[model samples]
Target: MASVAEAYVFLTYLKVLFLTVTTYLTCTAHNSPTRPMFSVFTSYNDSLEKTHGLPTNLSWSQLASTVGEDKTSSSCQPVGIYSIQRHGSRYPEQRIITTYQTFFSRIARSRINEEFAYLKNEPLDRFTVEKAECLTDKGYNELLEISARYPARLFPLFRDPVSIFTQSSFQSTETNRTKESAEAFISGLCKECRFITPKHDEDKLILVMKDGKIYSEIHWLPILHDPLLLPKISSGICKDSIAIEEHSREFYSFKNSPFVEEVLHHVISRLDYTGDFSMTLDELQSLYEICATEMNLFGASNWCKLFSQSDLRAMEYLYDLQEYWYSSYGYRINYLPYCVLLQDIASHLESSVASGSTSTKKIFKFAHSTTIQGLFALLGLYRTSVIPTADNYPLDGNWEYRGGIISPYAANIVFSVFRCAGRSTLPNAIGDVKVLITHNEQPLKIGPCDSYYCDLTTLTSYLRSKVGSCDLDEICGGVVRDLPMKT
Candidate 1:
C-alpha cells in the first residue's frame, strides 16, 4: 500500500512490545532451566497410553470414546484436524508434457489474469523475472487427481464458501506448477479457485531463463520485499549476473561466498523509504541499502510490501502454535515480523467468533517450511537444524532450500486451520493440524498413524496437563517458543 498510518500508535506499541516481549521472553526461555518434557496424562477408563506433541496421530474410535467421556458438554469442542495429503513421489519431468521457447515468455501469460495488475503501474514487465512460472503436465495432473481423491477432506469445514488458504508450491509458480495445482484442488468441490500469478517469475519457486541462445538459465532465488518494518538483509540475489550461465563454476565460487555478510546487509537498508526513487547507476547503492535494511529486520516480503505495489503485505494469518515452546521464551529466529502478523490474524479470528460469524469460516496459509522451522527453531519445537540446510548455500538458490534424494521440494509446509469455539471438537472443525508428506491427497506420511481413539484421549489429557493456563488466543500469542533469530 502507498501508505498505511492507520495504527500509528498501536503499531508503535506493538513494535516496542513485540521487541521487548521477544527480548525478555527469549532471554527467559533460553536461560530457564529445562524440565524433562512430558505429554499430558489422559486416562481411558481401562488403559493408559502416552503420546508426544502435535502432528501426532490417533485412531477414530478412540475419539468417539473421548466424546463419551465429556458427557458434561464442555464449552471447548474436542476435535482434531489434519494436513490435507497425498503420497511421497518425485517431481516428474515437464519437457515431455509441455515445452516453451523460454521461461520468460511463460511468465507474461500467467494463469491469474495479471492484465489488471499490469495496468496499475505495477507493470507486468516489472513483475517479470528472468524466467517462467508454470508446472509440468505430470505435476499438473498429480494435483488434479489429488483433489478428486480428497474431495471430502475439507468439505466438512467449508461446504461452499471458504475465505483464505495457505498452500505450498515449488519450482516457479509455473503455469503447470501453481496453476495446475490450484485447478486440480478447486475442481474437486466444483469451487472456482483462482491462481493470481504475476509475470515476474523470480518470486516463483524455480525460474529458468535463456542465455544468449545457448544454455538455459535457472534461478532458485526469490524477491521478497516489504517496505515498512523491514529486515536488515535482502532476499533477492544480485542482478548483474542475470546471464548467470556465462560465469564459470570457478567464477561463481567466489561470488557465492558467505564472507560478504556486509554485502547482504547493505541491500536491506532501504526498506520503507518514503523518497521517490528510480533505477540508476548511483541508485544501486541506495537500492542495496533498502534491501539490506529490510533483510536485517524482516525478509524480502516485508521490503516488497512497503515498496512493492500491494496494498497489503503478507495476508493476515493465524497460527495456533504453542507458547513458551517448552519453558523459556527467548525470541527465536522464527520471530520474524511476518509471524507477528500471523498471531494478529489468529487473535482476530478468536475475537470474531466470540461475537458472531460463520463458525466454519476458516483460512489456511501456504507458507514456506522455513516459516515454521524458524518458529520451531525459535520455540525449540524440534532441533533447529531440522529446517534442512547445509549452513552454506549455492549461488542463486532458495534461502530455505533443503535437498536430498527426495529433492527436498515436496512442498514441505505447515498447514493450519481456524475453528470457531462451537465446532472446536466437531469432526470437520477439529482445530488440530495434520502432518503429511505427499504431492497429492495420498498421504506419504500421516500422524496419529499408530495412536487409536484411546491415544487421542491421552493427547487431550496431555494438553490439559502440560499446556499452561493460556487460552486459545494466548496460545496464538507469540509465547510458545523464543530462540535467537537464525536468519
Candidate 2:
C-alpha cells in the first residue's frame, strides 16, 4: 500500500526496466558471434509454433528421407510389423503439478506484466498435485489419429482387407497412461477387436520361473512388468546415483554459463518482485514445464509468452543436455539395458521368416520416453560428435538429438519386415528379407542400413555384434537375470 505518486514512480521504473532488458536481449542476440542465430523475429505466432522441447504433434517435422522409395518395386509383402511406442501426451508428474501449485499461488498474488496478465486469473482447476500424469482427451484423440495414419502409410504392405485380428500382439507398461494409450491406439487400428481388461492380478503377461517351472505363455495383451522396457528402473542397480552425478555436473555447468545467467537475470528483473527476489533452478524448470504441459493441454499458453524464442531455445538446450547425458550417449552402461529388447526384435523377425503364415503380423508395445531414448542409443540413431556441454549453449551444427523430436509425448519406433520376391537392392545371399525402421513414422537411415530398405541379415548382424556377450546381471551388479523368452 503506497501513495498514488509512489505507485506511479514504481510503474515507470518497471517500464524502463523492461525496456532495458528487451534492448539488452536484442543487442546480445545480434552482436554475440557465439550466440545461436535464428531467422529474423517475425511474429510471436511463429515462435509459438516452434515447440523446442515441448510435446508436439507426430507430424511436426518431416524427417529426412535417404532411400529411393520410388525406385524400389512393390513386390515385397509385409511379413511382420514390430513397434514400440511412448505413451500419449499426459499431465506432468506430481512434482511438476506441485510446482504449478507453488508458482501459480505466487503468481496469483504478484503483479504480472501486461503480456502475461491472463496468469493473474489463470485457471488453477487442474493444477493440483494430486491430479496429475494421466492421459488427456487431446492425447487420446491424437493417438486415434496416429493409429489411423500408420495403417494408411503402410497400406501397401497390408494384406488386402487389412486385419490385425488374432494375429496381433499389444503390450504396455503397468502405468495408467500407457495402458490407456494402448487401448486408444488399438481402438483406432481396429474398432471391432476385444481385449481382456488390463488387471494387475490376472493380466500379467511376462513369463516367470517359479521353482523352475514356466508360469505363462504368449499374451495377447500387454505385460505388467517388462524388463526389456524398464531395464534400468526395474533392475536393483544404483544407476540413479550415477545419473544424478552426471546430471548435476552438466546442469551446474549450464546453470553457471554466461548465457543462462544472463537470461535468468533478465527473467527475475522482468518478474518485478517487490524485494530482492532470486529465482532457483527448480523454479526455472517449473516455468518451462508449465509452458510445455499447458501448450499440450491447451493449444496456447501464457507461460510461453514470458520468454523470447531465443530465450526458450536456450532453455530447450538445457533440457536437451539433461536428456543427452542421463539417457542417450551418456555412458555405454546407460544403453546396454536395451540389448535384450534389440535381441528380441531380431529373434521375432527371424522366426517370422522361418515360419511364414503362422507368425504374428503386428506387435505393438506401449512404453515410456526412456524406452525410446535407450532404443535410439542402442541403434545409434541421432548420436552427435559434439557432446552437448554447458559451454556450448547453442550447439553449432544441425544437432539432431533433441528431446522433442526423439521422445516427445507419443514418440515411437516402428520396424517393418518386408519379404521381397523380385529383384531388390539387398544381397541375395542373406535371403530377400528387407527391414524398414521408422521414428514417428519417418523412415530412418541408421544402424546397419544406409538406405531405406536394410537387409535382415545386416540388421540382425549389427544387433548381435553390438550385443555380443551382454549380460544384464553383470551390468546391473547381479541383481536380476535376463528372463528367457518363450519360443
lDDT of each: 0.27, 0.63
Clashes of 2: 1
Q: Write the per-residue lDDT of candidate 1 for residues 269-289, one digit (tens) a residue.
A: 222132332222223222222
User: Given candidate 2, what's the lDDT at residue 147?
Assistant: 79
lDDT of 2 by residue, 1-487 (tens): 4698899999999987875765344322322433322211111122223333222223212111223453442556566788998887777678877876787788777775555567778778766665587887767776676776655556543323235434667777877788778778866664433344333455544333333332222232333245677777665552432446644577678867777766676667666656565676677767767766665666456666565545666777777777777777766556777888888888777666663347676788888777888888878777786777777665333455577667777777888887777543443222477777777666677675767677777888887877766676676553322322110
Q: How far is 334's C-alpha from truth in model 2 (Å)?
A: 1.5
Off by over 4 Å in 1: 1-133, 145-150, 158-180, 189-338, 348-353, 358-360, 367-379, 384-487
lDDT of 1 at 460: 31
Error of 1 at 320 (Å): 28
Q: Candidate 1: what lDDT?
A: 0.27
